[model samples]
Target: MTRSYDEWKAAAAAMEFDGRPVIGGVRVAARSGETIAKTNPATGEVVSQIHACGQEDVDAAVAAARAAYEAGEWSRAGAGFRRERLLAFAGLIEEHADELALFDSLDMGKPVREAAAIDAPGSAALYRFYGEAIEKAEDLIPVTPPGSTALVTREALGVVAVIVAWNYPLEIATWKLAPALAAGNSVVVKPPVEASHSTLLLAELAIRAGIPAGVLNVVTGRGSAVGRSLALHEDVDMLAFTGSTEVAKQLQQYAGQSNMKRLALEAGGKSSNLIFADCDDLRLAAQKAAFGSFYNQGEVCSANSRIFVERSVYPEFLELYAEAARAYAPGDPLDPETGIGALVSEAHADTVWATIERARRDGTIAAGGTRPEINGSRAFIEPTIVTDVPADHEVHTREIFGPVAVVAPFDSEDEAVARANETPYGLAASLWTGSLARAHRVSQRLVAGTVSVNTVDALGFTTPFGGFKQSGFGRDLSVHALENYTDYKTTWMQWG
Candidate 1:
């Protein structure tokens, strides 16, 4: 909060992508010697030139990771050492939080203050949580016949390749990286090419935190090149990814076609905000629902794009939601007063509006449907509210991944639950009501990985986050995510 816009500008101007690519604990250039331009989504200006890696780079990274794993350097350092090292990494993340936050904002066009408050610190917190988790974890004692003793222990999956999306670059990647490393697996992180600066900086910080070289590697490029190669690499023992459903499916296919590597995916979501008739604090519920739908310019995978309000309160809730939306008028991300930052990229912004345009054909635009006047192409969309949307409309059923939402009404509790579950995605949902019995009953009925009662977008360090159905499987966050990076091996011995 103390840093000014000039400070952020200076930091961005001085950033050096000169590290190229880090492999085996050293910075190296890609075999192809290729580079990709990362642009600020707000200004459409080149932020940095990141070394683009293809099949060759992926091969080298995976090889390095495999060698590191087999060397028993990080993996065999034992849980206590890993814990200390991970904590050190977390400390560095905190130490450089301001710069890292600026990197995220400048690279992806998130509001600087928002990025600082949420993404940067959250990443550090995740690392710290995983760091402590490894210390308390224990091997299991198994039941056995009287003459035998059996012990089951979890072992790291050699090399984990993580692919994350452009939105929430640092936060989401940390969700995958923390547990993977904590479980003693080496990793090759492929952050979304459009926003790689912060991730690249993060990798450098990891080394400073004392993670051995090759223990954590970052390869930046199009998903088609680096991501495809890494996912299809046989030496990679596991793949953990957070991105679009289509891409997640592709990764699974790569794994199946290659080594059948273990996969943990947290993909797309068309989540719902279900407001009941007896909702507590109607104004706050509406406001939170709006925030849930449009935060981060609505770039969240779990954005509550589909809002179902009880028929009795739908109109009032809609009005309050519209009021909240208006407050988030799009503006320059670097401006401290600005609320709605630019969309991640001009291309993605176009895709978001295209979905909104399609929704207009069959839905009513309640508020803020038009594009804002911004410097860059498709840089921002006014926080939008759509109503009278059919249950099966694209806006209702698909993930817009922008500052857009569709509000509809439901008559009964069963109807509300039914409407919420109608979509193929069941990632996250929120229920607002004062009735304890109804909350429990409806929560169970709604088919989603995470459910919030009397709240919206309720997520943190302690719990698992994921989805059901086409939204993808497995979880992120929490110690629960550690399961993806390790497998249990049981040993049985006969005693004299």
Candidate 2:
């Protein structure tokens, strides 16, 4: 709120961005000497040339991470020491919040207002939460036979490789990095090609906050090169990734082909929001439905892109939802008052527009679906709502990964649940009902990882965030996420 749109735009025009790879706690050039043009989604301008990593760069990063893990500088450090350093890292993130916010806005077209207010602060809070939680991890002593002792302790899995999606670049990275680092594991992060600025800056900040050299490294490039190398590298003990389901499956195959490295994946979703006629407030439900579907330009993994309304409320809810969806008009990312920002790239915007066009052919366009020109870039698509979609249509099952909502009507509670669970993804689902019994009943039957009653994409650091079935296994947040970066070791002693 401090900066006007003009002021923010001016700051971006004069901003100096460093897109060099960060390895072994320092800014390093790619061994391949290749680079990719980093484009600003808002203005369609080449902002910087980011170093593109090859297999050689991946090897260097892996070797450095393995060395750091085996050297006992961070992995074997005392919990209190790691905790203090992580807390300091969190503080530095807060200190440089504005700069990092600008990185997200300019790098991937995230609204600077949203990035600064939510993503940056949220990333800092995650680090702080994990920093405080690390020391609280307790070893277990189990009851054993007489004259025998057994103790189980949690230990780090060395050299964890993280590959994150472009949307919410810093926040999603933190979701994996905080718990991995908190568990005392050395990490190598491969940021999405479309948005690497914030992640590179984050790695630099980790070094500044006293994380040891080689403990955290960032390799920036296409997923085909850098991500594939990490996934197949025998030296990597684990891979934590958040991206497409297709990519997640590929990573799984690569893991099996190599060393069978552990994989923690939070993949794609075609989540649904079920609105019943008996809801306490239909208007509130419609607003939340629109927010859940269009927030972050609807690039979220757990976005409620599919909405199922009861037959009695379908007509009324669809209108309210369409009205709410149209409120999120695409605008300049640096604008403090703008709710919706540009898509990550013109290519991605085109893809989303194509999806909208298909939806129009397959169904009815309830609200916005036009690709409006913004800031001289063709990457802006207004929030769209599609209604009267068939049950077996591809639009209902596919992950659009854009600000497009599909609405359908169901007659009974059983019918609503059935339609909602018809998708291949089981990442998240939400329901709105006035009856407490109905809420619990429908929630129990929803085949999703997280079920929010009368809410959308409900999550926190205290709760585990992940999916079921093809949405990918393993949790990301909470104490469970720390476990993903670690394993348990049990020791037994017998003496008579």
The runs of at least 3 residues in candidate 1 whose Cα sits more than 4 Å from the true structure, single-residue gaps closed, are: none
Candidate 1 lDDT, 122-219, residue by residue in tens: 88888889999988999988788898998999899899999988889888889999999999999999988877777788888888988988999988
lDDT of 2: 0.92
Deviation (Å) of 377 in candidate 2: 0.8
Model 2 regions lying over 4 Å from their true place: none
Q: Model-by-model lDDT, in order?
A: 0.86, 0.92
lDDT of 2 at 316: 94
Following a full C-alpha superposition, what root-mean-square deviation does model 2 have from the true structure? 0.9
TM-score for each candidate, following the candidate numbering: 0.97, 0.99
Which prediction has the highest TM-score against the true structure? 2
Output the lDDT of residue 252, model 1: 86
lDDT of 2 by residue, 1-496 (tens): 4788899889888889887889888899998888999999989899999898999999999999999999998999998999999999999999988888999889899899999989999999999899999999899999999999999999999999999899989999999999999999999999988889889989989988999999999998999999999999999999999999999999999999999999999999999999998999999999999899999999999999989999898999988898888768889999998879999999999999998998899888889889999879999999988887787776687898889888888889999999889988899999999999999999999999999998999999999999998999999889999989999999999995
